[model samples]
Target: MLDHAVQSLREHGVRMTPQRQAILEYLVTEHSHPTADDIYKALSGRFPNMSVATVYNNLRVFKEIGLVQEMNYGDASSRFDFVTSRHYHIICDTCGKVVDFNYPVLDEIEAVASQLTGFKVDRHRLEVYGTCPTCQAEQTHTH
Candidate 1:
C-alpha cells in the first residue's frame, strides 16, 4: 500500500519527502477518518520538527490532487479519509468512529432529480450516523 501510494504521488508530480511519506503511510493504513490534529499528534513525536500546520498543508495538497477526501461531520474539525473510491461512511455518534461501507451508486436518484430540475446532476454523498455497537453495549451495561 505504501509503494502504491508513493507511485500515485509520483505520477501526480508530488514530491516524496520523508514527512510526506510518513503522512501517506499513516493514511493508507488508517480507516478512522482522522483529523489533522490527530495526525500531528501521532507523528510529531517521530518527526520532532513537524507542526500541525504542516499536516494541514499536506492534507490540503493531497485533497487537491485527489489522493484524499475531506469529510465534515458537523464537528469543529474536518476529518480526512484516504480511500478515494466511491463508498459511503457510517459514523458512530457516541464514540466518533468512522467506518466505510460500499453500496451501489444511486444513479436513479440523480436522474430523477435532474429530470425534475432540468439541470445536470453531478455526484452525491451519503453518511449514516448512529451509535456503534460498542456504545450501545456500554449503554446496556450502564443501565
Candidate 2:
C-alpha cells in the first residue's frame, strides 16, 4: 500500500521527501483518523525539525491528490482518513472513536433524491454513533 501511494505521489509530481514519507506511512499504518496536531506529535521525535505547518501542508498535498479524505464530524479539528475504499464510520459518542463499517452503496436513495430534487447526486456519507465497548464498560462501572 505504501509503495502504491508513493507511486501515485510521484505520478502527480509530488516530491517524496523523508518527512512526507513518514507522514504517509503514519497515515497508512494508523487507522485512528488523526488530526494534524496528532500527526505532528507522533512524528516529532523522529523528525524534530518538522513543524506542524509542514504536516498540514503535506496533508493538503495528499488530499489534493486523492490519497486521503478529511473528516469533520462537528469537531474543532479535522481528522484525516486514508482512502482505501468506500466505507462508513461508526463513531463512539463517549470516546470519539471512529470505526469503519462497510455496506452496499445506497444507489436507490441517490436515484430518488436526484429524481425528486433535480440535482446530480454525486455521493453520500452515513455515520453511526454509539458508545464503544470500552466506554460502555467504563460507564457501567462508574454507575
Alpha-carbon lDDT, every model: 0.87, 0.93
Model 2 steric clash pairs: none
Runs in model 2 lying further than 4 Å from the true structure: 105-108
* Per-model TM against the reference: 0.90, 0.93
Q: What is the C-alpha lDDT profile of model 1 across 53-140, one tens digit per residue?
A: 9999999988987788999989458999996678889999898899999876554777888889998988778889999999999999
Segments in model 1 whose C-alpha atoms lie over 4 Å from true places = 105-108
Clashing pairs in 1: none
Q: Candidate 2's residue-wise lDDT over 25-72, tens digit each?
A: 999999999999999999999999999999999999999999999999
- In angstroms, how far off is 57's CA in candidate 1? 0.4
